[model samples]
Target: MKDTHKHQGLRNQLVKIISEKGITDKNVLNAIAAVPRHLFMDSGFVDFAYQDKAFPIAADQTISQPYTVAFQTQLLAIKPNQKILEIGTGSGYQTAVLIEIGAKVYTIERQLELFKKTKFFLPKLHYKPKKMVFGDGYKGLPEEAPFDGIIVTAGAPIVPNALLAQLKIGGKLVIPIGDEVQIMTLFVRNSEKDFEKHELGEFRFVPMLKEKN
Candidate 1:
């Protein structure tokens, strides 16, 4: 009972921060609140989960800052039961968020170590995806084409065309694009193969490196 109380208290604090920072979607707020951020972080850093900052998990990568995750998720405008494709699973933190919001998530991670780690950890959080691929995220998940939404956690020099191809018409894809500094951009698939883009704002993230399997 004490552990549960601690978890809920931490979640409420995060939700309050998200609200004050203009994260208006109640569903998004609740989803973020529901997922235990501490579970996705290192045990030594569990107390830091509610802070509005990113923390190193493993594999030389860091989980995204809370606001960044909320902002990107808000841009996606996820609806209940929508099919979501996530590129760069990282610590599986974003994946848990998507699942909490009732999305059927399919995630792809290029790094073998992160992929394996996320695969093991995700189920422990009760947020395992519908499908998880250990392959190049630049390729997207072609077998699971026509996803309702796509989110990329890493910064890329340019948006991968393959990811755009996987979006359903009227579907949204949120990604961070640039070399050193990045601008989170939103792409809307308007037709069979056409997409329109809107740049949100500047953000920083680790580069999305392709791993040869």
Candidate 2:
């Protein structure tokens, strides 16, 4: 409930750390800097908020590392008002970053604990998505199909075809693909049936659960 000068100072240090790690996008950096990440976590873990690492949140989900969030966001190259679909709305941290960067977001979460908490929590921080649903991330959000960019926060055993199909032609899907550990993968829909794929480095994320777990 409090974003003090001390928290802002820590966030600035975090922004510097990630920048040194090679995050060059100013808007992305500003968004990361603007969002009070400490507020998203429990009071006990707030001290770890501005660190360059992920920490546990409710329902066993971990808010993604600052570096990882910045890296995925940098990959998207988002523009203001672009429609973005986010899979795995854990803590709604990444969703807040996207909203800060001015993207219209539609997000889904499978963990009902998080879904319900974040559904209301995000707006309290004045970071609201266009839609937030409690559902499966693997299937993506079909009704809001053809997203300008889709971001999957959790690791997937394989790239879900449904997510690929939901992308607008020329839109990008940034997801981590693998088990145990994941390789960050980006798929850009060039046409109805064609996608350009690039495999970035590795990352670790909670499994993208299916159905209501």
Candidate 3:
């Protein structure tokens, strides 16, 4: 529960490493520094929390690698107070990063165990999303439509049309698309029927399950 000076020093080293790797977004890097990522992992893995790697958590889910989180977040171009929808809450590390960056986030998780655990855990760290849901990521949060940005943390077979419809004009959706391996993809809503697509690079993520288990 305590974030010691040692933890802070480790986070600074991580920021420097990722910055050299081309993570130029200072806001994203600062958010990464502010969050106590060690608190989101199993105690046995805490020693590696700042290593920019992913580790297994409950429900067979892996907290996304820190570099991956920063990459997706940088693509979003998140602004303070922007309404952002996050798919896949995992260990809530990414959610904490989003909150630290000042986004009003609504996050959903399919795995009930993770959903329940994160819901109970985040607030204790004083990192809270606008809403935490137990539902299908493919469906998204339509009731909170027209988001400024939508970030999908898991890899999807294809981008969901529902997510497209939820984006406001000029908004962005950062998602990874593929099965065995994913191409980190971004879609910017240029108009009601127009989008600009860019494939950033390759990334591997747990598959985004269509239905909640």
Lowest lDDT 10-residue stretch of candidate 1? 1-10
Off by over 4 Å in 1: 1-3
- How much is the lDDT of residue 144 in candidate 1? 84
Better by TM-score, candidate 2 or 1: 2
Count of clashing pairs, candidate 1: 0
Estimated TM-score for each candidate: 0.95, 0.98, 0.98
The TM-score obtained by model 2 is: 0.98
> Candidate 2 lDDT, tens digit per residue, 1-213?
799999989999999999999999999999999999999998899888998989999999999999999999999999999999999999999999999999999999988999999998999999989999999888988988889999999999989999999999989999999899999999999999999999999999998889855
C-alpha lDDT score of every prediction, in listed order: 0.89, 0.94, 0.94
What digit string (tens of lDDT, one per residue) describes model 1 on residues 60-84? 8889998899899999999999999
- After superposing candidate 3, which stretches have Cα over 4 Å from the reference? none
Candidate 1 residue 16 Cα shift, in angstroms, is 1.0
- lDDT comparing candidate 1 with the true structure: 0.89
Candidates ranked by TM-score, best first? 3, 2, 1
The parts of candidate 2 lying over 4 Å away from their true place are: none
